[model samples]
Each structure stands twice: as C-alpha cells, then as structure tokens.
Target: MSMLGVAAVIGVTIATFTTCGVGLAHGTGTWCALPLVWFIGFPLAITNALIVGLPLAFLFCKLRLTRWWQFAVTGFICATPVWMELAEPFTSVRWAQFGLYDSLNCFGSGLAGGLAYWWISQKVGIRRGTDEIAP
Candidate 1:
C-alpha cells in the first residue's frame, strides 16, 4: 500500500513539475517540445523519483513522520530549493516568466503527493490484518 502510494505520488509530482517546466518555456516564447519531451522525461523523472523519494520517505518513516502533513511539508520544502537552483542558470527575464506559479506548482505537487500517499495507504488495506475470517 505504502509502496503504491509513493509510486503514485511520485508519478504525479514528476508529471506536474515537467508540465510546469514545459508550460513556462512555452509562455516565454521558447520552442517547448510537448509530447516528445514528456515521452523522454517522464520515465527519467520516475527513475529519479524512486531513487530519491524512496530514501527520503524512509528517513521520514524513521523520524516517525510518515503522515500526510509530514510528507507534504517535507516534499514542498525539499522541492522549493531545487526550483531556485533550476532558476539559477536562466536569465532573469526567463526566470521571471514563471515567478510565483513555479513555487505554487511545486507546493501543489507536494500536496497532491501527500494526499495520494495517504489515500492509497487507506485504499490498499495494508494496515488491516489478514487474519480476519471472511464472510
């Protein structure tokens, strides 16, 4: 359950971030590749998500912070600085093309990830015992 939840969350997060990037590029009059870029990027981002998010999740688990808020806050905070780093290489004009929406996208993605995590865990019956007699 938790595993699926994490997978879904990471899936959505990567999609959202990559879309945001493409959208920003397009908004700024850049030659943004839509379908082609998504085709290439999603898999790579998913790999990164598993590689990175899993360890971070494990750490959160160790800290007894596996709840939604914990994941949400952790994901948001962790993601925001990365956004800043992404902005660093771009010119001020291009960076300004995104502005607050970039941060919002990150926050929304984190929130969605957290909710998906919690929701999947609930739906998958992982916390429920297997010993109950079937009616």
Candidate 2:
C-alpha cells in the first residue's frame, strides 16, 4: 500500500473511534456502561462489520444492487437477529415495553453502519473483484 493509503486508514480509524466514543458517552450511564461499551461494544462492532457487513456488501456489489435502500433493508434484516435474540435479556427495566423501541434502535443502527461502510468504500476508492485490479 502507498503512504497515502496508510495515512487514510489511520485517519479513518481515529475518526471511527472518536465517533463511537462520543456516541457512547451521550447515551446515558457513562459510568458503568462505558467499559462495557468499549470492550464488548468495539468487538461487536468489528464482528458485525466483518461478519455481517462484509458479506452483505459483497452480495450487493455482486448483484449490482448497491442502492442506499438496499443497504438499509439488508442491514435491518442482518441485524434483526442480534436484537431479537442476543439483546433480549438486557431489556429488563421495562422488558415488556422495550422491544418496539429497541427493535428500531437496532435496525437503525445497522442501517447507519451499512451506509457508513458504503460511503467509506466510495471515499477510499475500493472496488471488488475485476474493477479492483483493472484501470
């Protein structure tokens, strides 16, 4: 990779960390939840991006359906399982009433993440397969 590519990566990494850190701080319970947000949260972000985000993007790119709406709906479906399955036990404060709101939260978050990936890929000049190597 070129020096400019390395610099761009460093900048994006810092920006992502700062964005996520500030978001975590503003969401209440900065005391106890902050640590979990860093440890569990960052890992989950990496996991979702790699596991779910990469494949989804590949499918979209392969199918030539890289529209924003495609990203949103694909993201929503990919993330629905995490919210419905993994996040259920934590909604104890108002368990019965939390699903409606948290469901949206989870889906929106996924959509945003997908859009971010697409935007970043555009900004960074990445293309998959043949276009990635061809002039």
- lDDT per model, in order? 0.53, 0.53
Question: What's the alpha carbon RMSD for model 1?
Answer: 6.4
Give me the runs in candidate 1 sitting further than 4 Å from their true place. Answer: 1-45, 126-135
Candidate 2, residue 26: Cα displacement in angstroms equals 15
TM-score each candidate: 0.56, 0.58
Q: Where does candidate 1 clash, by residue pair?
A: none
How far off is residue 101 in model 1, in Å? 1.9
Quickly count the clashes in candidate 1.
0
Give the per-residue lDDT digits (tens) of candidate 2, residues 1-135. Answer: 232223223333443455456545667322234345446545554565566666666676667665556655675566666666646776376445444444544565566665555556657765543354333
Q: Between which residue pairs do clashes occur in model 2?
A: none
Estimate the Cα RMSD of every predicted model relative to the unseen true structure: 6.4, 7.0
The top-ranked prediction according to TM-score is 2
* Model 2 poorest 10 in a row by lDDT: 1-10
Predicted structure 2: clash tally: 0
